[model samples]
Target: MKLPILSQEIVITLQQLEGIGNKTILSKIGSIVCSSISTLDDLLSFWGNLKGKKFEAISNDDIKEANRIAKRIISRAVDENVGIITYYDEEYPEILRQCTDEKGKIDVPLILYYRGNLKALQIPGIAVIGTREPTPNGVKAGEYFSGEFAKQGFNIVSGLAVGCDTTGHVGALKVNGVTTAFLANGLDWESIYPKENLELAKRIVANNGLLLSEYPIGQSCGRYGLVARDRLQAGLSKATLVVQTGVTGGTMHAVNATIASKKPLFAVEYRNDVDISHEKVQGNIMLIREKGAIPLRSNGIDSAVAIIRGTDYKQVTVTQPSLFD
Candidate 1:
């Protein structure tokens, strides 16, 4: 009756197997919460004792192929200075542990492939998300709000996409504050999505911040991966702030995940000032009106950030120069 808590290499190797992916592991998670199983040998030993065999083991050929692929990934990970952390790892982020679907199943990937400081994952973070094509004012809100959060010692979390995501990362960096950029693709420079932000990605890691992803090295960005990327942005944060979003886009995925988790979902009040015909602010309005999301004021401390900042000591804001106007 042992649980399978594996090492970095074992977890990464399991991820390559179609039959033993995160979902499969999570389905049996309740049984493996303790220390009875801690390694590949322990797992195999436990598997041999199963009377009815609740889990399915992969074929020998599949195991060999997975190991071969994992070896290459391990080499690339070392060459790129990338680090791997398993769900059972002591350093794994607790905030990300709350990422689950409607069925209450664990939604986080069993293995997190990251760069920069892993310690940042433990820091309280605020996710800043919005459309890839934000209005001029939308970008301003992203930068202003994110920079303000950074000053308060909260890690700025955002998908390292263009538009609001770019502004979110830039805003935090301007103040020399910590920011964690979650990518839809590999953390490697060549495989980083949106070649335009490749330098920005490097800058984040250089500033002692963090660049994170669930995808392994050599994996390119895909459409569904971006949607999946949104979930992690919301799941890893204390709250999620929508700088701007249309009726439908990748930002909504984060918004939905935040609400599903019953965390503080905040949308910028910029939607109120904009014209009704504005598409970008439409989703913002919907979130405030229909989704019970707290409205965030652009000018000063709105009700939401007030809850985030609390009665803790306050500090003057440090605004960052915009990277893209």
Candidate 2:
């Protein structure tokens, strides 16, 4: 079968596989289909016709949730002018293509529901995520790096949540740099969360940044949705930095995803003791020790910027543009 036909068929089939992980199922099918497996029927038969196999046990409510997501995506795609990006789409991030499985299955998402311009994917991005409620130190550090990283030409990415995440976005804006917010809730590309950042989110777009989500527009925010959102924020970036987190927090999820994707992960370590309740600290330590993430210097903004920009750490001499006297 044609590649487009096969890809389309597999997407629909994976979409219908209740209780099956969409990414996992798509990964499997993607491996075969990408390798010259002919058609959906041939692919299904090869896999023992797993398609349409009823789950041994699942409530109607569970099925309804899946349907709700599907329907919401469809309705909002039309109603809110959203666009659907499948793994096969040309605009799929090339960075994610590096994450191939042992069986040659890529970690690419099956589909990404999007509502904004695709330009953000081409820019070098740094994700900053941490506890929802941060300490004063965490908040200060988050702002510092956010501005520093943006000045280095890295587009800052974060959940639009309060605390460190929000600070990251604002810091980027303070430098007059671009930033993108990846949301956990289903959002029309134009929508902003926490209501307060609504203005900030607007400024980002006006500055040629974007607001993005994988969920269909209008889907309610859920715990799992936030978790899913974190993965995308990590996946979409060249590297990630956790400014401050408690022993357990969503920042860890983003860190883990960065590790699993084999991208560079870095942590901003405060000189003082980081609290466990903050939920981002332990994860950062674990990532550094076990996952090999580097510990970034708290005071080396210039050095970090030099490394990112591939230039010497010296301040550049500004050349004044000549104007009519």
Candidate 3:
């Protein structure tokens, strides 16, 4: 499953270039690197054609720094047993290749660093996302729906954040189901965000799940990175479920990305008896009322399962007696 050694080196070098991480810039570079060039021997001709072009303006110093960084990245990846999948690699996920933004711009990452089963990406899955802080009801909903989906053979996809996301992964693992965690930082343990999820991440890998990232080794998580990571979570799934969320947060970003990508979105609906004024469930209401997201009955795993299976089911508002009820 290894790429040609030379191709791997060249791809890593391109990733190390400053400003190449930008999707538009990376797309342009990818066209050249994946098309006219296949190895380091072709880099000269590729560089010569765009010496003064705006997108191809890499200085000599930039090349030197890129070489150094690429070497370090390669060394670290090996030391950590992290797997690298470039855009041109055959192992790259096909679903990711079709992802785009609201404006129809391609939003796929140029490379991915992963640990554990790459095969898990090929399985049917749904992204489960929600607020970092969730009400007890929201946590139960996440666990119930995700665990139900896992039992039905759907891999759970989510960002490794706290609250609902953590519960989602735990639910899947409870049933010995596969799950994939899309990280906002590098795959290295030193950069795993929240620090608390380090054990959770390990459990995922141990349970045949995947820990994936677009950043290279040593990169730290940042606001923009987390925002960007949301797209991959949506892109990787057949559908996205918002267990609970406030109007503003990473969960909303994932919802927007799912809509932009034209994936099916299901938002949990709290029963009328429950307090709807809670900020945690505001985003779910907004999504259902404003964004046309299908309303998922509270604690109704069958409704979610039917949708994924493409069977006819009532989309009418459903309800759960309580969070765990």
- Candidate of highest lDDT: 3
Model 3: runs farther than 4 Å from truth?
1-6, 19-26, 32-38, 55-65, 102-104, 311-325
What's the TM-score of every candidate structure? Answer: 0.86, 0.70, 0.88
Pull out the clashing pairs in model 3: 297-318
Per-residue lDDT tens digits for candidate 3, residues 1-325, read 4322335666777666766665644546554444545544475556667644653677656765776677788799989999998776788888888777545567887778998999998888899999888888888888878888899899999988989899889989999999999998988899998799999999999999999998888889999888888888888898899988998877877788888887779987886445377898899889999997887764567766777677544453455464532
Candidate 3, residue 38: the lDDT equals 51
| Candidate ranking (TM-score, best to worst) | 3, 1, 2
**Number of the top TM-score candidate:** 3
The stretch of ten residues in a row with the least summed lDDT in candidate 1 is 316-325
List candidate 2 stretches off by more than 4 Å. 1-21, 28-72, 98-106, 189-193, 272-293, 305-325
- Rank ordering of all candidates by lDDT, starting from the highest: 3, 1, 2
TM-score winner between candidates 2 and 3: 3
Please identify model 1 stretches exceeding 4 Å from their true place. Answer: 1-4, 33-47, 50-57, 102-105, 271-276, 309-325
Better of 1 and 2 by TM-score: 1
* Candidate 2: Cα lDDT at 317: 24
